[model samples]
Target: MMRNFHRWVGLVLSLVLFVAALSGTALSVVNVLEAGRAIRPASTQTVADLAARVQVAHPGLEQIRRAPSGQVSAWWFDGGQPGSAVVDPATGRDFSSADPDPVRRWFTEVHRSFFLGDSGRIVAASGAFAMLLLAVSGTILAVRRLGGWKRWIARLRGPLAGRLHTEIARVAVVGLVLSAVTALWMSAETFEILSIDEASIGAAPSPSGRTGFPLREMEALRALPASSLRELSFPAADDPQDVYVLKTDRGVGYVDQGSGKLLGWQGLGFWQRVSETVYMLHTAQGAPVLGIFLGAMALGAAVLSATGVLVWLAGWRNRPRIPANAPAARADTVVMVGSENGSTWGFAATLASALRSAGHRVHVAPMSAFHPSRYPHAQRYLILAATYGDGDAPSSAKGFLGRLGELRVPPSAPVAVLGFGDRGFPSFCGYAHDVDAQIRAIGWR
Candidate 1:
């Protein structure tokens, strides 16, 4: 019963989860293409040369700064006159001011939070929670179908919906968890409680006065590789007091404007680094394989959602509708049920559709409402409930433990129990095992 309650709630949340996963997949590759196109000539260009080139163009410029994508910023006579342009690595052509598609930004907003801000954050977090539930429910379903968790690893039967759901679930569970955890982490960071902010960094001062013409020297700029740059800040002015601020994947530091001399470096805090990595992993930046993985997970999420609905709808359409005057719960050939949330008198009423149709007057009721008297005319008792968290019982079965102890019945009834669970959990269907043992000890004769 406790398990059943968890199941229905999980089912409803699967819809939102579907959206989150699909959007994540789309985002994984979208920006990758954009990043690839934002190319520049020699990603390793020096602050001095880049400064001179853009400075020659923007005479009023005090300095030149470069973005991660090699976009150059000419900070004019004053920083306020900053002019930006993307520099093509092959041509040194300016492309910095290029605007990415607004549609992509919009899509990002929708994917991240449905554009609701804090509430959107909750939505994303809630979606992660729902995904966790789905993975769990999928595992439970697989274990029960295989007769036991021990059996599930080897001899599981291959029912289409159940089999497909579990197999893909087993393979995709890791990816799903990766995605969910990162997404949740991002959501947490968005809420500010996680505090992923990096500390403020000030570059070391350059040699004061008499700036050398480092811009004309090719060898100095060629010494550094393009990949090392995260972003580069050129000297602030001709006074040579300003150094090159280079933010790299490893740390933030300054470079001597004339000699390319490396300066004081500071690394990012753990939380800041972790947050940055998580965002990249969640979006598959720099690694196409991870992006492909995200896409596959999205595909699986959709498949699981579809099959779940198909499995439920199929059973629903076929389930018998028993009349109120039907024979004793024990005498009826079979029992059937139609449910929404599984919160109704499910365990104490009727267990499920197929079990009720198999020529058995099933004793079905919400787990909390179950009474031994309800099965007075039955010989066999069957319980089909969905398992919730790490094998916890659903809400409908909350009273199962207490009621099982309270009810006294003839010691001749034998029961068969079936449970449903997601395949993403370690303890799938654990609660069902607990329930079955209790039923056996009761000696329902």
Candidate 2:
């Protein structure tokens, strides 16, 4: 059942995930490059110092913003013309154009929303959600295929596509899960579903009718170190009521232009902090190394999707077609198969054909589809069960034990279990043994 769920979901979202993964990988590379090129501010540098220097360079300085990577940019109105540039906190001078790289922007738009705007964002979020499910379900299947967690890195014996898919998943699942979870959180915040907005800072207090206050002398901005600076907006020249709005890692504050006093302050809200952290994790803005690591993992996601499809196709190609398969209600005997990767289905087909040759009407189905209620004429049940991770049931038999326990009274027909697995594993045929024991306990012969 889990295999089916994992396989179908993967197939449905394969293209979406592939595109996201490629775009995400490109963005990650861009992030790391940007981080490398970014200028790190000195610890001693304070927002006041940076603002003062920028104001000196551009007399009509309007705002200063600091990125998580410590890159600073300043915007100003010089000679009544608006201008902006990447500012060096040390020199407070334009070092680079403030304009975003078009290529990076394109990749970002594609990654975040697939260039579809709001609808694209929803689709991206859905892909993230699907990726998460695939990761979890794939993890379970991988562990089971390997026998157990202790054998997590054990040598795998399977077709190339299946082996490659599992190997890549083992290495990339952690990163994939991280990316998926963070992406979902960011998408939630973007859609206002999670509400990361800062708590209201309340109405701005009446400025002390002050104007032309030196930003260097503003107690609020001066006390704020460059490390914590997010943004600082200067009050408009024509508006006496305007104030210096300072946002920092700690919170947001309003500073009186005339007195340079902090008029109002509000600490960062819990949700806002969570959102920031999620953003960092997802974008790797503040963590470039993680960005690169996640990018490699994202590439793995694409590869996994491709290999997963190949594995599915291979399974279908190799699946043995049963002949004259009898209906469950009319069959004198029922043959249930519990297999991963469709291998056990081959055994079921063989058994069904043998029963038919003996003139016994046989119904063949996956163990998960087991339903004695639909087989009233059944004289016996034949179960071909395979053990999965740590003696757990394989994908096809996921709910078989539960269904068996749900029965108020055991079936009167005799039941036989055939176990399949490698003896190299400790739990070899464990699931089949479990089925046999359960059948005996339930009074089945």
What value does the lDDT take at residue 205 in candidate 1?
55
Cα lDDT of model 2 by residue, 1-445, tens digit: 7778898999999999999999999988988988899996789987888888888888889889988778899999878899999988888889999998898999999999988999999999999999999999999987877776888898765579988998999999999999999999888878988765675587798788768888788887788789898888888878888888889998898999988899999998787788788888888886888988989999999999899899888878766788898888899999998876678888888888888999999999889998789899999999999776457787778789989988878888988899987675677788998998888777767
- Compared with the true structure, all predictions reach lDDT values of 0.59, 0.87
Relative to the true structure, candidate 2 has a C-alpha RMSD (angstroms) of 4.3
Cα lDDT tens digits for candidate 1, 1-445: 3235334655687677667766766776675565566454454555335545665566554444444433443444434554545554444445556454676677688777788897886887888877766666666655554546565555333347755666777678778878778877887777776876664566475453445545546343445555555565567555567676666666677666656566566888787788778987787766666677787887787677766665555545533343442444545322212122332224424444455565544434445555546556666555666665456665546657667766566335565666665566556766677777787677653
For this target, which candidate reaches the highest TM-score against the unseen true structure?
A: 2
- Give the poorly placed runs of model 2, Cα more than 4 Å off: 321-338, 343-420, 431-445
Tell me the spans in candidate 1 whose CA falls farther than 4 Å from its real position: 1-6, 35-85, 95-97, 147-159, 203-207, 210-212, 216-223, 238-240, 256-260, 327-445
RMSD of each: 6.8, 4.3
TM-score of each candidate? 0.69, 0.80
List clash counts for every candidate, in order.
50, 2
The lDDT of model 2 is: 0.87
- Minimum summed lDDT over a 10-residue window in model 2 is located at 194-203
